[model samples]
Target: MSVPVAMLMAWFCEMLLLNSRSNQSVFRYSASFR
Candidate 1:
């Protein structure tokens, strides 16, 4: 609703998206290694 709140939410969502993407890549890499 407020500008700062919206910006914070957007940043948080981006962080979560990046973390999940990195985790997926790591899982795939480890699976291949096995």
Candidate 2:
């Protein structure tokens, strides 16, 4: 793997991690209101 490719993969993984974390927080917040 090249340097740029490796950086891109790392960035993509970070984005996915951030998105999942946010979604989980949102789900929990909504659940608390019920």
Candidate 3:
């Protein structure tokens, strides 16, 4: 429950979300190009 731990968790969640979005975008782009 420390501030640093909370910040780290938040950053991790944000990175996961970003990765998911990029994967979705890559899949769509590849499908369209093919």
The per-model lDDT (C-alpha) reads 0.62, 0.63, 0.62
Alpha-carbon RMSD to native, per candidate: 11.6, 11.6, 11.8
Each candidate's number of clashing pairs is 0, 0, 0
* TM-score, predicted candidate 1 vs. hidden true structure: 0.59
**Candidate 2 residue-wise lDDT, 1-34, digit = tens:** 6889877766765576577865666555544534
By lDDT: ranked, best first:
2, 1, 3
Model 3 clash count equals: 0
For candidate 3, the C-alpha RMSD (Å) to the true structure equals 11.8
How well is each residue in 1-34 modelled by candidate 3, as lDDT tens digits?
6889877766765576577865665555434533
**Per-candidate TM vs. native?**
0.59, 0.59, 0.59
Residue clash pairs of candidate 3: none
Runs with alpha carbons beyond 4 Å of true place in candidate 1: 22-34
Model 2: lDDT equals 0.63
